[model samples]
Target: MSSAFRNRRIPTILVALAAISAFCVGCSDSEDESDSTTTTTTRSAEGADALTPFVGTVHFPPVPFAGSDGKNHLVYELSVTNFTSGKTTLDSLQVIDADSGAVIDDLDAAEAHQRLQPAGSRDSADSLEAGESGTIFLHVTLDESVAVPKNVVHKVTTTAEAAPPDLRTSTAEVGPTKIDSRTLPVLSSPLRGERFIAADGCCDASRHTRAILPVNGQTFVAQRYAIDYEQADDQLRIFTGEPTDPKSYFIFGEDVLAAADGTVVGTRNDLPEQVPGTFPSGISLDAADGNYVVLDIGNGFFINYAHMQPGSVRVKLGDKVSTGDVLGLVGNTGNSVAPHLHFHVMDGPSPLASQGLPYLNDKFSITGQVASTADFDRSEGTGIPLVTVPGLQTTEHSDQLVMDQNIVTFG
Candidate 1:
């Protein structure tokens, strides 16, 4: 899949190619009775009063992520909405390669206008106005000696002064996608030998660790690989005496295990805990995941466990839990700012309405690296050190794939 985007044709005014060939024959007749490995294909071009304007989807991440530097990355997401009542301008988005159509990477219009969303403040309007929705956070690394692009192609393009028709283009078709990785366990380290801090791992352009969450009305971007786990030390200090004492921080209650072998499907113990350096007022999104736990752990995955520890939740809702079993401790409650854990792996059990897949951890080691937690929180408030790196560093990350700040340890 690399013939560099063959025969590019861009011009359309009132598209319908037999309604896009009956929407690709009803997506190949429900993808042959659907077993679901995640494949999606779409293409559109409308204007002459039929109106569509832009409309996008992309997703893709069933496999491909061998990267700890060995390459093969992939990671997708395009979203796009703008449905025309007025403003529209995306004008470029590429990614192609669906069997030799090549192109591989292109999203740039000021980083797609800073990854649009809510579009109400950076002085608004980077185009998408009418219905307004935006995501574009792709990745694509490939080349660990080749052979990974089974299917892909997201090629979008737009422009609209009320559909004047200067360019339309749409493409879609995401993948043969299937990289189901989920080997859990090693979950017993909400903090053990000490220094921790992966603060927003996996694809974090920080829309609060990957955004676009709507839920009931649907929109979903569900954390897309969430991971916040915090606690720091060996000089990369996180907090000490009186920051509203959630035990002055060093990972307040700790524990939190059960990274696999599950069945609990939901539990949310009382909810209170939240003081360490503040933040958590008027919270509600059904308590924004404060004292949580979700588990299921079967094929369609489900392992949530966010901001735990109010009563330290043991396991309930159906109770079957195994691998390192403990299930609860670490706290600062919902939408926290301190005692961290907030792990993720979802497809459902409703932790913010699911969909954040990708899991691996069968082992971990990489011992030193705080690189800059805002220069270790300004060297723990001005003792002035900057890039601390304490000791013990072997970097043993097998079947590895954990991003953001990474300073692992677990067995």
Candidate 2:
């Protein structure tokens, strides 16, 4: 009986100790035993018979904001470390879902090793120099339909192309789910820096862009004659410089606000702003639409506000914005002759497919004259002759000029 009792007590004590160790010390590798048996097997299979093993890790950044599609997508960043004696290259990467074990994403470096995929699995076709490393990025959508348990396991696999080609794999588990929300401005300044026109033609036909004026008192002109945009960045820009005047130099940098709520789907911020100029020395960055912002407004529709000021952008890379949120001030940044706000709508993420969508100004004042939407384009639209308030205000009829260009010309 004593022996039997001791046997039972031994198992009970071991179980208790294991439980305590798990709770107190946590689970981590405590030994550095080189499993030569496994190593040899893997080496023989990879044909690297002489090459050693390299290990690395992958991580992802948080999502910028929720999309109008009601789906939350996050960008993943992956890093790899090489421990060999020479350099190597990787061809591709793949990510597998933890719950379903399904492949989530894949990335591959293409010709000249330009494109790099996000974390998860990588190709074994590329060579990795000993002690060399690489990184990549990918976009992944979160699964919202499933209920996850405490700790879920995920698997990652990588394939490489090297002197001794072999397959590399890794696995990790995801903890609980958490959602975070933060707010920031959406629109951005138009004038980025000094840029040259990449192509010719109007908005959709050209590859570059232009800027617009946010304040009144700036004079803008149409492309006088289909002129070449080459060497336009070196031209001199005209500005009104008068916050209250309607006839002045162009406004390049002003405060811009968000038109709606949405996450930043795409952004290109490093473009140089074009200098103001006329024929002979035209603006270089001349493109139709000009410097602008494209905001996703849900239901496959994106609103674009173009032709903005330079060096006026305030938002960072990833930020969420609300309606009427300040994005940046308007100015002539791209293929613009004068300062003007160019608005349009598009179907896809690109502005090239954007169609001229009609938008109603919540309220605005017309100081000089009023022109119908149709007649506005003929003579740049007639100016509003009335002072706009909640209701209306009486205006003096002393001004007799045709207020074209939808502006309220003040004298």
| Off by more than 4 A, model 2 | 1-54, 58-60, 64-71, 106-114, 117-128, 141-255, 258-273, 276-328, 332-411
Worst 10 residues of 2 by lDDT: 224-233
Tens-digit lDDT track of model 1 for 368-389:
6656556645543433333645
Q: Candidate 1 overall Cα lDDT vs. reference? A: 0.61
RMSD for each of the candidates: 19.7, 20.1
Q: Write the per-residue lDDT of candidate 2 for residues 1-411, one digit (tens) a residue.
A: 344346544333333332333233322553322433234323322223222233544332222223222333443234456543444455444444444555544444452133242222243225445556544333444455532221222222233222232123211221112222223123222112221111222221211111111113421112200112111112222232442232343333434556567555544344344444321134443354445566776656555666555555555445776766766656555655444445443444555433222122222333222223233222211221222123334233221211122222112
| Predicted candidate 1, C-alpha RMSD | 19.7
- Per TM-score, the best of the predicted structures is 2
Give TM-scores for every candidate, taking all chains together and pairing residue i with residue i. 0.31, 0.32
